[model samples]
Target: MRRLLLVSCSVAGLLALLPASGAVAVELPMRKAGLWEMKVLSGGSVPEMTMQQCTDATTDKDMSTAMAPMAKEICSKQDIQKTATGYVTDSVCGISGITVKSRAEITGDFNSAYTVKTSSQSEGGLAGAARDSNSTIEAKWVGACKADQKPGDIIMPGGMKMNVKDMEKMKALIPKK
Candidate 1:
C-alpha cells in the first residue's frame, strides 16, 4: 500500500505539470474544490487500489512541486502533447538503479473529472530484470471535503491519511549541505 501511494503521488505530481494547452504554460484546468476519489487499476506486480483526496487550487499547486526534490536527480526528457480531449506525456528517468520509460494519456474535463492511463517499463534493476506495468487512474469530484478532511489530505485504502504538502515541507527541511 505504501509503495502504491508513493507511485500514485509521484504520478499525480508529474501529471500536474502539464500545461493548460499547447500555447499556454499554465496549470491544468482546476477541478472543483472538494473531495475527489481516484481508482487505480495497476497491471503487473502492483495491486489495484482506490483512495480519496481533499483538494483546492492551492493544494493542487503545492502538490505539483511535491516531487521537485527528486525531479532533478532522477527525471529527464519529458515530452507532452495537448489534444482536444486531454493530453499525452512521455518521459524517461532513472530511479533506484533503474532507467524508466513512461507514457501517460489523460482525458475528460479536468475541472470536474479526469482519467489517466499510464504505462511504463523499467530496465537495469531487480537483478537485471526488466519490469513493465500499466495503470488506469480515474478521478472524480465527490463534493465538499468531509468534516475530518482538509486540503492536501488523501485517505488511502485501510484509512491511512497522507498530506502530500506536509511531506514536501518535511523534504524541504532537509539540509543539502
Candidate 2:
C-alpha cells in the first residue's frame, strides 16, 4: 500500500506541473513613438564673445580640431538609428569676456517603431577669455516604450548622429563645484 501511494503521488505531482492544453495566448502591445530629454551643465560663458570671437579662441580651435577626429571614432562605436531635429543657441551675460551656452535637441523613432525625442544643452568659458563660464543642456523624450528603452537605445537619426555615450562625455566636460 505504501509503494502504491508513492507512485500515485508522483504521478499526480507530474500531471499538475503540465500546462493546460488549449490555453489562450496574450499578445504584447506594439511599439510606439516616445519622447526623451537630457540636460547638461558646463563651465563657461558665450555672451561676451560673438560666433567669430568664440571660434577664434584657442580653446575653441582646439576643441574643434579634437572633435573632428573624435566624432568619426565615437560615431562608429555608437550605432544609433532614427531622425533627430534640434538647434544650438549661445548667449553671454555679465562682465565676462566670453561666456557661451549651446543647446541641441533630437527626435526620432527606433527599429521597433517606438518614437523618441531628446534635448541637450551645455555652457562653458571660451579659451583665452576672462571670467568664469557656466553652461547647461537639457533633453527630454516622450512617448510609448520610453520607460522601457535604455538611454543608449535611442539613436539620433539622419546625418546628425549621436549617442548617450557622447552625451555622457559631453556632460563630463561641464564644470562641477
Best candidate, TM-score-wise?
1
Model 1 bad stretches (over 4 Å): 1-26, 169-177
lDDT of 2 by residue, 1-177 (tens): 333222222222211111222233111121123333322333232221101011112332343334433333322221122223422221111112322221222222221222112222112334443322232323333343343444334333232334333443663453432
Where does candidate 2 have its weakest 10-residue lDDT segment? 47-56
User: Candidate 2 lDDT (Cα, whole model)?
Assistant: 0.27
For model 2, the stretches where C-alpha displacement exceeds 4 angstroms are 1-35, 39-127, 145-159, 165-177
Every candidate's CA RMSD: 3.9, 27.5
Give a tens-digit lDDT track for model 1, residues 37-155: 98887755567788999999888766655654444445665666777778777766675566778788889975688888887776775567776677788889989999998898999
* Decoy 2 TM-score against native: 0.20
